[model samples]
Every structure is written in C-alpha cells, then in structure tokens.
Target: MSYLEFLGQYGDRILSGTLVTVLLTVLSSVLAIAIALVTGLMRLSPNAVLRGIATVYIEIFRGTSLLVQLYWIFYVLPLFGVTLEKFTAGFVAVGMNLGAYGAELVRGAILSVPRGQWEAALALNMTPARRMIRVILPQAVLIMLPGWGNLLIELLKGTALVALIAVADLMFQVKQINGTTFLSAETFGTALIIYYVIARFMITPFMRWLERAMQRKLGRA
Candidate 1:
C-alpha cells in the first residue's frame, strides 16, 4: 500500500497510540521531576541518615538496568503481591530510572550556586527550608532547566521501551501494524518521523519557552 493509504487505514490507531505515548511521557516526566527534587535535596541534607538513604536509592536505581527494573516491577513485584498495571509499571520504571539521573543534576545545580548565597541566608537567620525555597533553589533551578530539558527528550525516547511490556504506545502500535502489513519501511519510518516531530517541534519548543519564562522570572533574560 502507498504511505498515504497506510496512514488512512491505520491513522486512528496510530493517533491513539501517539496519545498514549504523550500521556506516558508527561506523567513519567512529572514523577521523575518530583523524585529528582526530593532525592536531590536529600543528597544535600545535613542529616547523615537522609544523605545515606538518598545515596542508596540513587545508587540502586542508577546501577541497575531500566529494562530489568521494568520487568521486576511488572513481574517480580507480583510475586510479592504488589501488582501494578502494565502502564503503571512502564511509567514508574521510566520515571525512577530517569529520576536517579536527574537527582545528580539537581545536586550539582544546587552546589553550583555560589557558597555566598548560603551564608547570606544564614546571616538572615533563615531556616534551611526557607533558604532553599527563597535563595538557593531559585538560582539552582536556572542551572537545572537546561539539564532537565535534555532529560525530557531522553524520557520521550525512553517511552518506546514501554512497548516491550505491551503498553499500547506509538512503538507498540507500529510493531503491530508492521506485523500485519509487513511494510517495514513505511511503518517504521512513519514512527520515526512521529517521534522526531514530537521531540523537535513539541517538546523542544516547550522546554525553550519554559527556560525563557524562568529566566525572565529571575531577571536573567
């Protein structure tokens, strides 16, 4: 079939799959961001216990393979009666894996803030929380925006892995269509274009806009 004919025949299904891909990427990004912030803060905590716990989490997640983590969450966890749906397992695994990486970004960004900022907060008798919220994070987040933007694209690409566990994402649907039609070039090529459009047109623009907004807020624009 011609490419247009193929799209006409399977467009609805592909659209559905793209929507799922977008949803999964968005939810996973949110989860990953939250995890990064928490663990990243914990890594810098004065309390040794918090630091230790954060270190262990970062090490275990970063040390392991993401595919293995997915399988363990979907398969092994059920053995212990902590069952998760396929979609949940997919996003959670992706989020956790990326979050481990993002945590380091956060830690580094926070550290990149001038040491004088911390002392200024201390001089003002600011609590640790207030200092982070008021002074440190505002600066650190600027450094973080560029890294997080890169991570967002990585997360988008990583969503393809969810197809292995049978989430009906774009790649999963492409595989299904290709299996039936045997149009390897058309099917796979279309999928590639779709992913690129998302990352290039949608995700990239949004991240740039977000960075600009944050910069404006900080009077750095």
Candidate 2:
C-alpha cells in the first residue's frame, strides 16, 4: 500500500499510540524531576547516612541497563507479590533510571553556585531550607536548565522501550501495524516522522521557552 493509504487505514491507531507515548513521557518526566531533586539534595547533605543512601541509589540505577530495570519491574516484581500494571512499571522504570542520571546534574548545578552565596546566607542567619529555597535554588535552576532540557529529550526517546512490556506506546503500535499489514516501510517510516515531529517541534520548543522564562526571572536574560 502507498504511505497515504497506510496512514488513512491506521491513522487513528497511530494517534492513540502517540497520545499514550506523550502521557507516559509526561508522567515519567515529573517523577524523574522529583527524584532528581530529592536525591541531589541528599547527596549534598552533611549527614553521612543521607549521603550514603543517595550514593547507593544513584550507583545502582546508573550502573544497570534500563531495559533490565523495566523487565524486572514488569516481569520479576510479580514473583514477590508486588505486581504493577504494565504502564506503571514502564513509567517507574524510566523515571527511576533517568532520575539517577538527572540527580548528578542537579548536584553539580547546586555545587556550582558560588561559595560566597552560601556564606552570605549564613551571614544573614537564614536557615538552611530558607537559603536553598530563596537563594541557592534560583541560581542553581538556571544552571541546571540546559542539562534538564537534554535529559527531558532523552527521557522522551527512552519511552519507546515501554513497547516491549505492552504499554501500547508509539513503538508498540508501530510494531503491531507492521506485523499485521506487513508494510514495514510505510508504517515504520510514518512512526519515525511522528516521533521526530513530537520531539523536535513540541518538546524542544517548550524546553527552550522554559529556559528563557527562567533566565528572565533571574535577570540573566
């Protein structure tokens, strides 16, 4: 079949899959950001216990393959009576794996803030929490925006792996269509274009706008 004919026949299915992909990416990104911030802060804590816990989490996730993590969450977890739906499993795995990496970015950005800033906060008798909330985080966020943007894109691409566990994401639907119709070129090509458009047009632009907004807030623009 021609590409047009293929799209016409399977457009609805592809659209549904695209929506699922977007939803999964959004959920995973939010979870990742939260995890990154918590773990990153823990890594900076003076308490050895907090630092140890953060270090273990970061190493375990970063050292392992994401695919294995997904499979373990979906397939192996049930063995221990800790079952999760396929979608939830995929979301958690992707969030956690990327969160580990993003944590390092968060830590580095926070550390990059000048020593004088911390000293100034101390001089003002600002509590640690207040210092981070009012002074350190604002500067660190600007520095971290570029790294977070890159991680967001990577996380978007990583959502494709959810297909292996039956999440019905873009890649899953593409595989299904290709299997049934045996039109590899048309179906897979269309899937590629759709993914490229979503990442290039949608995610990239939003991230750039966010960076600009943050810069303006910090008077750095």
Candidate 3:
C-alpha cells in the first residue's frame, strides 16, 4: 500500500499510540524527578545508614540493564505477588531506572553548589530542612535542569521498550499494524517521524525553555 493509504488506515491508531507514548513519558518523568530528589538528597545525608541505603539503591538500579529491570518488573514481580498493569509496570521500571541515573545528576549538582553556600546557611543557623528547601535545592536545580532535561528525552525514547510487555504504546501499535499490513517502512517511518517531531519541536524546546527559565530564576542569567 502507498504510505498515504497506510496512514489513512492506521493513522488514528498511531496517533493514539503517540499520545500514550507522551503520557507515559510525562508520568515517568514526574516519578523519576521525585525519585531523583529523594534519593539525591539522601546521598547527602550525614547518617551513614541512610546514605548507604541510598547509595545501594542508586547503584543497583544503575548497575543493571533497564530491559532486565523492565522484564523483572513485568514478568518476575507477578510471580512474587506484586502484580502491576502493563502501563504501571512500564512506568515504574522506566522511572525508577532512570531515576537512579538522575540521582547521580542530582547528587553531583548538589555537591557542585559552592561550599560557601552550605557554610553560609550554617552560619545563619538555618535548620537542615530549611537549608535544603530554601538554600541548597534551589541552587542545585539550575545545574540539575540541563541533565534532567536530557534524561526526559531519554525517557521519551525509552517508552518504546514498553511495547515488549504489551503496553499499547507507539511502537506496539506500529508493530501490530505492520504485522497485519506488511507496511514495514511506512508504519515505522511514520513512527520515527512522529517521535522526531515530538523530540525536536515539543520536548527539546520545552527543555530549553525550562533550563533558561531556571537559569533566569536563579539569577545566573
């Protein structure tokens, strides 16, 4: 079939899949961000026990392959009685796995904040919680924004793997249509274009805007 004909037949399904992809990306990004924050902060904790736990968490997730993690979440977890829906499993695995990596980014960003900032906060007798909320995290955010933005795009691309576990994301939809119609190049090519559009026009620009806004907010501009 011609590409237009293929699209006419499957465009809506693909669009729906694209929307699912975006939704999953957004949801996972939120989860990843939250995880990054918590674990990242834990990395700075003075308590050796807490710091060790956070360090192990980050290392375990980061040390393993994401595909293995996804499969374990989807396939093995059910065996352990922790059942998750396909979408939920995909989101959790992707968010958590990426969050482990993001934790390093957060930890580094927090550490990169001038040592004077911490000393100044302590000198002012700011409470630990207040210091994190008011003094440290804000400054770290500007540095973290760029790294997290890149991770967001990685999350977007990573959603494709969800299809392996039966999530009806863009890649899954494309596979289904391609299997039935034998329109390999057309379906996949369109999927590629759609992802490109999202990454280029939507995700990239949004990340850039976010980074710039953060820099301005932090007065680094």
Quantify how close model 2 is to the true structure by its C-alpha RMSD in Å. Answer: 0.9
For every model shown, what is its TM-score relative to the native structure? 0.98, 0.98, 0.96
Query: What's the candidate order when arranged by decreasing lDDT?
Result: 1, 2, 3
Q: Which tens-of-lDDT digit does each residue in 19-53 have in candidate 3?
A: 89999999999999999999998998899998999
Model 3 CA deviation exceeding 4 Å by range? none
RMSD of each: 0.9, 0.9, 1.1
- Per residue, candidate 1 scores C-alpha lDDT tens digits across 1-221 of 78899999999989999999999999999999999999999999999999999999999999998889998999999999999999999999999999999999999999999999999999999998999999999999999998998899999998899999999999999999999999999888989999999999999899899899989999999
User: Each model's C-alpha lDDT?
Assistant: 0.94, 0.94, 0.91
Q: By TM-score, is 2 or 3 better?
A: 2
What's the lDDT of the predicted structure labeled candidate 2? 0.94
Shift of residue 46 alpha carbon in model 2, Å: 0.8
Per-candidate count of clashing residue pairs (backbone under 3 Å): 0, 0, 0
